[model samples]
Target: MKNLLDILSNPHKRMPLDTLMKCEVVLEKLDFKRSEGLPPSGAQGKEQIFNPLLEVVNKCLQSPLANHTLKRTFGSTLHALNGPEIKNLPPPAKIAKVEEPPMEIPDVLQGEIARLDSRFKVSLDTMQTLGSEGSISLFAELQSARLPCVPPLQVFVPRGYPAAPPAASVARAAHSKPDHFLKLLNKAMDHKCARLPKNCSVGQLLDAWEMSVRQACAPNATTANYAPVPALGI
Candidate 1:
């Protein structure tokens, strides 16, 4: 067996080509144990032969083509002598990189949109006022005055599409029943009148009521507060 460390140590630092050929000839002779008519021997003689073989192996390891050529020779010929096979070499690795897409304003815009959506329901409270019987009282007063009225007792019920005309349940209610609707309108008017200034006109009262209803429907709707009177006499 070869001394693995000795093979590593003298790894062909700088040997002549002719010396390399002579070393190969010596290695072949050692295999048959017929070096200068020396025959095979007992345990002590076996060790002596092994020492010389290891020296040759170490010398071969020092050759220029030692690493590649010796590994090939060992893998092929040394198998019959139960030598450990050389490990196959692995291929060189290929490295590839991925490029990420650019950052965008739209991504930030979408994040802002989502944030607003989350707050929309709660934020809507600022625009709406609750409905009470005051709304109902106003509906009653408009009817008593014999005014042509679409009594605005609506704005309270949850929104839905009308089965018939006007596309909305509130509009349908105004168109369908005039008298009964007026009764409710009057009551809503009376409630608002009691809270507002005594000199407030019928037109002023109606405006306030409409404003109130609009505020209830779209809590986010934009509108000015109810002013007492317009200088233009309206």
Candidate 2:
């Protein structure tokens, strides 16, 4: 134990890596004879013999240079020395947690959503207000019976609504490629919104979008007109 303590508290300002390795080997080989010379008084005997050794070992273990095997060996030796005392120790106390306040949507966006809910007769349960900027996202299903294949539309209302036009897109269908279709739809919606009066409501924008979708999907109508033409061949 004294030798181990000496190794742990080396007089050198900076111990060499090889010297530390030799010290570790000495520690691994040193036999901790707990039962041989210890006093018959259980806790008191162990405490007196092991306390200083325990302190040194703990400090060594805390060092950045202490590797996994050294830690495991020290842990096992300590556990064998005081297994009963450690097991008998009480569990730590629980900490009380404070709850945060719920987020409230802005009055202007809330009123617009309410109006949209009433006008479309659609549920606003799916609508989610995003961040402090007052932007919102929602999924709106097409009510047309003719367009059964078309998926629910994802609409994103920007921070400044009525002034800023909302962007809409459709999810890719298993049977059809909606990517091209969505690009045309959004482009047409933006063009229509740009032509609308400055004070146009979200509902009016959505109405224009629905009309565009119907026109794009019509049997006689072709979305190829909206698709960009290839550059003239050389």
Candidate 3:
């Protein structure tokens, strides 16, 4: 305490790293004990949490404090720590940060889209990005029999695929059914599908939806289409 006081009291004085570390160990033990003695909940938080911490701090203050810049800081710190907010105990739950897994192209899914383009009229293209995270655009002629209307779909497949579904969307808003498509897409490609008939690739999901969309949007589709409105002469 004297060493800490001496160092902080003098603007030119700085505590050695080792000495600070030693003090930290002692202070941490005192703090932990003080916290343990506090109310499990808010047993009148001020008396339970703040008062105990304040008392420990006061004992340190009783030692002669130099009238330096650090003196005002010390007083403020004690008051702030023991102020009104101290009564309520901090919640026990520790928030854990979930880091997204690095983007990986599964061997089964990798280069699979290329093989797909070779078989069907659909083409897969990569768009320019400002990041290392990559995306793909899939499309085909709407007149094609294999895929009557393969609207261009773009999806970001950064690290944390499968566990974190790809960020997906279509080129044309009028051609997209985002909510339905994304839900089905996630279900199809979810790597964590614990049931049988295993999860598939993003490309496959896109392809399946393309076929579904084409069928649903066929000129003869029983699902009534919204009538086109005439544009006014400009």
Candidate 4:
């Protein structure tokens, strides 16, 4: 036992196979030296904690039939007779759970945006340069460009009646024949007949329809002279 303890206390004894083989050797040597009888069953008692081999010791001490089984033949021969049963050993104490510290998360979006901007090879200077080029012209050239100060506009607000809807007058004109529609069309095209493009079919059709109605009927256009529109400015 003293030799086994000395060998186990060495720092170099690390491997499981080495420890198991050494323990087997110790048991075998102890058995050869002692030659004790096998232990009986129900041998549980106090001394099994420090030297657990005592539990095996108690078993070898208690077995009745001396026919020499492994535990009876070998184990009784190994260690001392005063050892206790292994199953009677006390359980290890419960350990407390440890609480971990909180971790801080990094801003993933900011990192991704910065990476994208670098990969695209873009700078703020290029955006400002584009904005300056598209600005509108604020001043005209120093030439007498004849801007129309007075356009030919006649806005007459008569005494009291409201103007009839253009829709009603158009409805009446729509009932006319295709030939009458053509004469009014020819008159509207008198000056612009040569100037118009050959592909201006839609514009030509609209002018012809407008001329077809000689006078557009206005039920609400009439105004009494009593309620007059006062002139504001020329």
Note each model's CA RMSD in angstroms: 18.4, 16.7, 25.2, 27.4
lDDT of 3 by residue, 76-136 (tens): 4446556744477768998899775543455644655457654344444434432346443
Least accurate 10 contiguous residues by lDDT in model 1: 160-169
Residue ranges of candidate 2 with Cα displaced over 4 Å = 1-90, 93-103, 117-134, 146-149, 159-165, 173-176, 179-187, 197-200, 224-234
Residue pairs in candidate 2 whose N, alpha carbon or C atoms collide under 3 angstroms: none
Least lDDT summed over 10 consecutive residues: which range in candidate 2? 225-234
Report the number of clashing residue pairs per model: 22, 0, 3, 14
Q: How accurate is candidate 3 locally (lDDT)?
A: 0.47
Could you give candidate 1's per-residue lDDT for residues 1-234 as a string of tens digits?
Answer: 333333334544444445544666655665443442554466455547566566565566578978785665444434645776688889878778755443222343234324532212111112333332111111212232223434333221122211111101122352465554333434343444446653443334345555344343443533233334322111
Q: TM-score for all predictions?
A: 0.18, 0.43, 0.30, 0.14
Against the unseen true structure, what C-alpha lDDT does each candidate score? 0.39, 0.56, 0.47, 0.31
User: In candidate 3, what residue range of length 10 has the lowest lDDT sum?
Assistant: 225-234
Better of 2 and 4 by TM-score: 2
- Model 2 scores what on Cα lDDT? 0.56
Best by TM-score: 2
Judged by whole-model lDDT over C-alpha atoms, candidate 4 comes out at 0.31
